[model samples]
Target: MPARIFKKSWLIKSIFFISAFIILVIGGTTYKKIEDLSQSSALLTQTYKVNVELEKIFSHLKDAETGQRGFIITNDPIYLDPYNVGRENINSSYAELKVLGKDNIALQNNLRELNILIDKRMEYFEKAFRFSSVGNYNDENFKENFYNGKKLMDTIRVKIKGMIDSENELLRKRQQTYESNLKVTPMFLYMVLLLSLVLMFITYSKIIRDLKKIKAANEQLEIFKESTKQSEIIGQQGNWIWDIEESAFTYSDNLYRLLGEEPQSFTPTLDNFLNFVHPEDVEKLQKDVDKMMINEDLPFIYYRIIQKNGTIRHFKACAKLHRNLDGKKQLLGITTDITNEIEHFKTLEERNLELERNNKELSAFNYVASHDLQEPLRKIQTFLSRLEDKESSKLSETGILYIDRIKNAATRMRLLIDDLLQFSRTNKSDKAFELVDINILLENAKQDLAELISEENAIITSNKLPTINVIPFQIQQLFSNLISNSLKYKSKDRIPEIRIVYSKIKASEEPQISNPKKPYYHKITFTDNGIGFDNEYAENIFVLFNRLHNKDEYSGTGIGLSICKKIVENHQGFIFGSGKPNAGATFTIYLPFI
Candidate 1:
């Protein structure tokens, strides 16, 4: 009899192993087909991206040509802005194309040739601009350059079109491949799944016949019960069931633990569970429970519970009417502890109130600085001026020197007050962004510093700047501050030469920008041949009232760069400074491509 039992067991094990092996094979096959389909779809997406980048390259070229023509016709520097910006955009697009087509040698070769052609075309644009700048539009050289640029543009268009057409053809083939895989995979999976189910059913029938004689079914039930208890503990939750017909309640083991008691420590009843609820919440919870009895359901309800140790916890509960296979109606309910969430919300509310109070204080401080403080400083300056002009002759030489000192002190104070007001204004909440020509802003800034520029004989040169979305006045202020800073720190030995260069750059290409918020940024750098500070103090220089040089050496409040930082931050941009002692400084600002 024992030998016969062993044979029966071996037969059951054999069937189970065979069924599992067949299912594993089917799963493996399905996975392979799915992977193939996914690869095909990814290839199709890559083809589309390549096409898009190619088109973008062509569009940027056209924009450059258009700008060149506009400049040729009117000889306006403003038109050159588009040309400059277009070149930057073209470079950015080409970089993206390189990354996208890194695996395709043909595409890489085409891109290389395309880049060369674009460079030649841009040279033609430069030559044309030079001729146009001198009003030589009708000259032979200008005419030849113009026609050559036109021909080059046409050639570029054909090259881009051909690349795009090639990508489109590749895309078409990939799409067909993807579609074929998509159509075949589902039918294959269905057939495999059907076969797996049949084998599983046969194995299940055999297992069931054997399990009917053993206690394995009861063991499975116990495993399920233990899994449910573990889930409730991990989730900080409890489950319960209510039998409406019998007016009985069944609580899970974790429910007792949730009440700070041992599992199964008390008989689960409606009144018994209510005993743990807080007095303030007990009444409301009783009403909800009563409604559940009548309506056979319970909407989500929030309440507080007091554990045996007197810890008050917030809870949220919900219930739904469910009928068992035995046709017994019960309310299945779950309750979760939400005390942490409630605490967090209260903390946030307090912080919000604190922020509001701080903002109000700042506003008050701004009013005082702009109005009350400036008024007294202005009066002091006015009185000092009167004293210097009228009482100078009657005063002794030492007294005259004292009066001069006071005048200088008062002038510095006035400058400090004005800078403070400007810094405060940078924090204004109402920021209006618009698409403005940065060249115009730069010109305006130069105009504001025209007298100073002329006095110092400082030479300021800049490349054509781009038109970008920015807070117009703020950007103008930023330009003014940077230019003024360079002028203020000019070297004594040589004339100050400040250069402003603009380009569009990818975030990944710039090491200073980590985890960049935008993919592209407009990088504008201010390079100056001034008495620059050490690189160690680069970040500190932008702090309000943080100056490298004493006030006696340099007439500045040190709030200028701070205001520049705030303005750039307000526009979701970044500003960085780098310098070498007694050499020069470069302040680079990156405005996002928004």
Candidate 2:
């Protein structure tokens, strides 16, 4: 997806560059064409002006010739006036011709020759007029001068016509050039403009396509933004951005809600945000914010903020520096409402204190049971022993039986106290776990109950056990209790055959272990052929002070199995007992493999 976006972006850039290059090329071509056209037009205008000036010069000469002829024919004062005016006009025409043909050597030379011819003709005209004024109307000199003046006038007309023809040729060529330029320029510009339009249309199409994609992307962004907002609200979180370059802040809607205000309730600013901070944390938070500005980063910071309703809540925040493609710097930050976590922590702390007090009281009770409570039981046993030894003969059978009952009660009380103390001490707190061989612990348990096993003539056999991490003493106690329990409940008709089996098994294989915490467990089963009770009392038997039989039927303290349960629990293990009346009982214990 990223690659596709990059490809699209590169394509857009290429199109833009190509379009811009095309436009520049078109502008340059048009400018060059326009410049050529302007020069052609200016040249044509100059050619026409030259032709017009040439025609004006010739017309002025013609006017002077006509005036001279009129004076030679009439010899009147009006004719002299015209002749004088014509001469003056001829001189003015010569001056104008010189100025007009200054840059044309050929035209200037022609004008100079024409000037000589006009001067000769003017001399002939003056001579004729003088002869006529002296009454030499038929004089040969006057006739010859008049004929010479006519020939000179004809030569001047021929020279002026040649100059005019040369100018007309130049004007015709310039007109052809102007017409050719006008025809070719429009076609060239039209083709160029048509190509530019095609390029423009293509560029416009690409731009419109890109715009649609951008619109789609913007819509997706808006959806994602809304999703993020909902997530923040659900998770008790909020986000913000600090544009470091612009010194601007943008807070999410939830951020405003976190501060106990409506979204966009006011302009987001450091001062405005600071107003919601608790008075005690304001200075520390300000310092942290200052550090963030300097470092462009922020570590996890904890502070308290007071809502508008005056409820104080704990908040945790952190931020990192982010730089955009344009190299603008910003700090993206997230803040979480940790008030619930703080409250939970406080509750846990109070519970811990209460637990500590309870443990102290329990320890005091254990001390009393071990020393103070046991002292009287010991005295009672001693007194009963003395009475039985020294005064049993002096008492009646009933009194002796009463003394035996008292001894039994004292012994049971001692057992119950000892069991209770062991159960209390079977807690896991402060207990160091060590890797020990389970076989060794089992052997130790058997050794502790060696005398009882011998009396029962129990056949105890076990399989090899793996080494496991556990509280050693507690596990040893657990094994001893189970072995002793089996022995105490041995069926009178059969010799107790206790089998201790060990194996590694998956928790899933054990149907009794639901929602097992560990993947594997060390399974140790003690099966015995003993006076097993009904299976109905399997769970109840593990309860403290719960007995399946009366004291007369079973010389056992119910506290023993409860202690076994507690010890197994200390090692994060489970124990189950199953039995049938007058049949073998099986006790299974599962300890976590870890």
Q: Compare the candidates by TM-score and give the number of the best one.
A: 2
For every candidate, C-alpha RMSD to the true structure in Å? 52.6, 5.2
Can you write out model 2's per-residue Cα lDDT over 422-453, one digit (the tens) per residue? 87788889999999987899999999999999
Report the Cα lDDT for residue 559, model 2.
84
Instruction: List, in order, the clash count of every candidate structure.
Output: 0, 1
Give TM per candidate.
0.57, 0.77
Q: Candidate 2, clashing residue pairs?
A: 491-531
Q: Where is model 1 poorest over a 10-residue stretch in terms of lDDT?
A: 1-10
Best by lDDT: 1
lDDT of 2: 0.85
In TM-score terms, candidate 1 sits at 0.57
